[model samples]
Target: MKVVIVDDAPRVRDRVKALLHADAPYAEVVGEAGEAQAAIRLIRDMRPDVVILDLQLVGASGIKVLRAVKLAPHAPRVIMLTNLTDLEYQITCLEAGAEYFLDKSFGFERLADILRDLARKSGPDSEERAVL
Candidate 1:
């Protein structure tokens, strides 16, 4: 699996990468971006399988990044990881086309499970299951 991590805090990025590595050591960290523009550039360049983004960014916010990513060609599916628990925030992110909304306070193991689920859903066979 390939992923681009976008978080304003370097520590958050490191932590996420470590958890992902623990889950799937083979998973590649294609890129890491701290701000919106860097995130945008990384997406365009790496075109990763999935993106783990923070809701609060240094600029433009993660919501904007979600919107931008969704608009990209063959855009990577996004999962929002943040401390924000507001219903409105969740609703807005879902509306913006986020594949998952996860709380960062939770264990990385939880996110790893979600990442697997998302990958399964992205596969071709998932369409058949969706009909059921």
Candidate 2:
């Protein structure tokens, strides 16, 4: 599975990358971005299978990035990770087409499992499409 991570913090990106490498080795992290416009461009150019996005960014908000990604051609699956724990933010992100919305503090393990499942389903030998 091809993946892209978008976060304002370099450490968050690094941690997520490390998790992916350790738990989902088959998932190739194609690109990463710290802000919205660059993230949009990277997602468009890379067409990764999934995007792990932070809800905040350096410039434009992550929700804007999510909206842009949803509009892109062959839109990739989105997994939103945010420090914000507001129910409204979660609802809004989901309404905007995020496949999953998770709190950054508690979501890494779930993210790893999701990535592993995505990688498995996307593998050449797999014939089933992941339902979520």
Candidate 3:
């Protein structure tokens, strides 16, 4: 599955990329962006199957990017990975069309499993399953 990662922290981006490389071999990191506008542009241009988005960006909120892209004709599945663990933030992101809202500290490792499942469900030969 094609993947785009949008996060302000280089370390976090690198770690996520490395994790995907090691655990989710079916996932390819097609692009990376550190800010909101760039992320929106990259996601539009790349049209990746999945996007790992951060809640707080360099100069803008990830919610803005999420809202913008989710309106596209073929919107990608978005997983919000952020340090913000507040219930309000999670609800907002989910309501805004995020497939998953996860805390960066505790939920980081769950990303690969989610990606793998998505890949399996989206496989060309497999029966299509609804992803909510």
Give Cα-based local distance difference scores for all models: 0.79, 0.83, 0.86
What value does the lDDT take at residue 62 in candidate 2?
A: 93
Query: Where in model 2 is the C-alpha error above 4 Å?
Result: 119-132
What TM-score, to 2 decimals, does candidate 1 have?
A: 0.88
As a whole number from 0 to 100, the lDDT of residue 123 in candidate 2 is 36
In order of appearance, the predictions have TM-scores of 0.88, 0.88, 0.90
Q: Mind giving the per-residue lDDT tens digits that candidate 1 earns over 1-132?
A: 789999999999999989888886656889999999889989988989889888888878899999998887687777788888688888898777777777777735577776677666645223221100
Clash pairs, candidate 1, are none
RMSD of each: 3.8, 4.1, 3.7
Instruction: Give me the candidate number with maximum TM-score.
Output: 3
Ranking by lDDT: 3, 2, 1
Candidate 2 structure, TM-score to reference: 0.88
User: Largest lDDT belongs to which candidate?
Assistant: 3
lDDT by residue (tens digit), candidate 3, 1-132: 899999999999999999999988989999999989999999999999989999889879999999999898888888899988687888788878888787787777898988887776653233232222
- lDDT accuracy of residue 85 in candidate 3: 68
